[model samples]
Target: MHIYVYFIYLIKNIFILQYILEDKEINVFHKKEGNMEMNKPNILHIFVDQQRFDTIGALNNPIIKTPNINRLVKTGVAFTNAYAPSPVCVAARCSMIHGQYPANTGCFENDLMPLDNRQTLMDVLTKGGYRTHGIGKCHFTPDALALKGFQTREVQEELGVESVENYPYMEYLQEKGYKHLCEPNGVRGEMYYIPQPSQLPPEDHPSQWIGDRTVDFIKENGDNNEPWYLFSSFIHPHPPFAPPNPWHKLYRPSQMPLPNIPDEFESLHTFVNKCQNRYKYRDNGFDKNLIRTMKAYYYACISFVDYQIGRILDELEKTGNKNNTMIIFTADHGEHLGDYRCVGKRSMHDSCARIPLIIKQPGKFDGGVICEEAASLVDLAPTILGAAELKMETHNMDGVDLYSLIKGDITRKYVFGQLNYNGMDFIDADADFENYVTNKECKRAAFSTYMAANSDWKYFYSAPDNREFLFNKKYDPKETRNVVSNPFYKEELKNIKSSLINHLKECGETFGIEGSDWKAHKLPPFTKDPDRGLLIQDGYTPWVDTYIPGYTDL
Candidate 1:
């Protein structure tokens, strides 16, 4: 019996060593194959909504305790500078599925469809012999075909009863005292005293259900020997900031630093800042303490989401496919969390544009390699399809294939981003929306959101007001100073503007205007006065300071 026990122990150790050796050989085998995986390593794309770049523990943030994500960082490639192509949920997720920029897909605004069926990444993957699946929020319009692609198991209808429309399972949860989900607004909604529904234990949360379904899929397919793509989409840390119980108290607010709310940052956002004063959470009926508690709860939501991810990872490992899987993690966009005194993702700043992207290509890539090269969420579909060796020829994708860099090809110079003032358009459709509709607006005026590489020389242009924001990321990653007007850097400004123009042109984005010499009307400048109706501040024209409370003013 003693000899048998020793023999079994030796066998277990041998198996563990073999696994480690196999992991090391992944990259070598990939290089040798050079774009060939026997059946294409199984793809697991984990997408979360409204997550910021600094929220995870392994990244620069030491405050947020995200153990699972930290583990992912230790064992995968963390793309430090990954950005959303558009800073809105529906738009960014559409880009992720199609590998195309908003301009190419025409789903440039919230509440819009993908515009064409031939464009989604699922269409490509399905044609490639891979089974695609999705779980969680489907915010896009006409979600029918999309659900069919993945055999989606999502919570339809709104999540709470106060909602004008019934979310799929919201009524069920609400009747059981999950009332907080019905509160239209969270801390920002100005409804704090509203009693929160009893926090759902992690096991009962919607995210957990999604994880279980994914586990089932993995187990069923683990031994089938067929490559699969499972997109487990979670909608936590997005709203009400109500991260259920236990999770709500999981982290202490004092330990978690307040977001970098730049002093007088509200002044920078002339449109949103003005409206904020008219609708404080207190005036809307939330208790002051409730608001504070909700803020803490939002952070808790982040931590809770992180915990769910840990659960999914455990399932992945337990199923024996962890070694051959290529797991891609990212978010649609980011939540402002009061940064710049903004509550949501309608701005073009880093807080709204920058997001986290970590990819774990087991056996094909190593852990601890941080890639600082700029990457766009739009590049996601192409990268995944390329890794799966699936042809993306039929789809008119605007993003570049980024699989090489994931396999250790990092000679990339710059990544690109675009903007749509979608929310701004809601406020002033006649101004910006008219341009996109008539195709007359040339630059930022006609678009919603915009971003460019965080190069030593960076330039931000708003086409409507002909406004320019120029900064040197090498000197100021925070983008506090707008040096577009500094005459000392005139040559550098001109060069960057030229490059910007060339980039747009290369992507087949024509403004119908010529040359990089175009400059904003500088003298006397555009301005708004109390006497002149609304101020054309922050390059947004026709922007009015207004608020329309939702939930019947509950």
Candidate 2:
């Protein structure tokens, strides 16, 4: 037993010793046999940032190609009604790990994270002897070298790593002299949604770097029989809408579908849309041709990530971990992709909240069945623990096992979400617009958006607006029309509102209630400082118009 080596590992990130410790040397790996395979299944959680639910090819969205994700859907159970815990990244991700709501984590925005002392899914699994390692982004704020129970991590955060010496991705870029081409998180500010190919080659792209690192990890640990958990997180399909080489030109922009701008619902009228419409997707200058151009790049980014997944899947098969591992794929939150004329996330709309969830474990369940039950990122902790045959140590988790939902042993009546919201998800705008969101009597400063949905209905309420929006998914799947004012659906609205209130109460949110009855109260004013993720570096130039004509218009 390498007891002394584990102490060394304890000092220097536990999973780095993953290469050193194997088998029962420290009891990290069980002796793999028939029964052991059933008992200790490996977990590989593939998480992407800002990917929308409708991008997968097999899922019936014709606009994009995602062959590898389609393979997962073909071989796994796909949850069609999955939603984010909250519509922003950090809130949704922290809630995911803790199996709690955003309010419980006190992270309605990216500014905060659950206290470090809190027991999370990764912590519990590590205690259960899983060798946990994280690659790519976690986006936990007050950015630490280690947070969220990942024994060791090679982060590719949108924000620059505080310790580039320790960050493997950054170090690699530096070593290869690709630092000049590295935008860290692609280009930011005005170019966030613009169509451009990455300056780096395909093999050197950040997504490719992650893919290679994961493949190498599998190769290094495959024969060790370690019951390992690897969070292979990717940073693509988020923004800058850039792909490298052939992928950038993989699609024709003219063929891409236009954004959903419903006539009945003016997106500009919403709080979030107003903040996002500043420059990247200005309402006046953003024509359908440019929207199509952006969609082409967006789809290209997703397809690039998909290719990386294919590499990981192939590696698992080569290492004979294919049947022994339980694979889970999901995103932190969905991207708006110009839905409702909004460029980025922080909306309660399906375009921003709904995500694709696929789980595959060999011989446990039927494949290719689209599980229609409501699911959220908050449910991942309990679900993954269930798959690993371990129990969650956290007492305040707010999720049920998704396997139960699929098997009909339990059902979720609705999936609910709330986000205090943000300023264009921390991207910059003109100074005047910034002042409006921060200092003025803007809607975002005063209201938080709350949402509740099931297969039958989608509901939203913004307190300061003193309005409610209800859309029947069956009749209006795109949520093009608000039926809250219609007398025909008054009873449904009443019942849905009652359900939402009870949910909030259950989650210990008393702010939305007044004496047992549901009531909307104007929230406290947003403070002057907003959490702009990864503050811009020095030598900033103003957003310049490229004047590149879209192929659709040409």
Best TM-score among the predictions, by candidate number: 2
Backbone clashes for every candidate come to 21, 0
- In terms of lDDT, model 2 sits at 0.76
Model 1: residues >4 Å from true position, as ranges?
Answer: 1-38, 151-201, 263-267, 270-295, 406-410, 422-444, 455-458, 487-492, 506-508, 511-554
For candidate 2, the TM-score is 0.84
Q: Write the per-residue lDDT of candidate 1 for residues 210-259, one digit (tens) a residue.
A: 66666777777766445678887777666646566676677665555555
lDDT of 2 by residue, 378-413 (tens): 899998888777887656788888888887888767
In the order shown, the candidates' Cα RMSDs to the true structure are: 8.7, 10.3
lDDT of 1 at 304: 73
Give candidate 2 regions above 4 Å deviation: 1-38, 267-269, 279-284, 422-445, 516-554
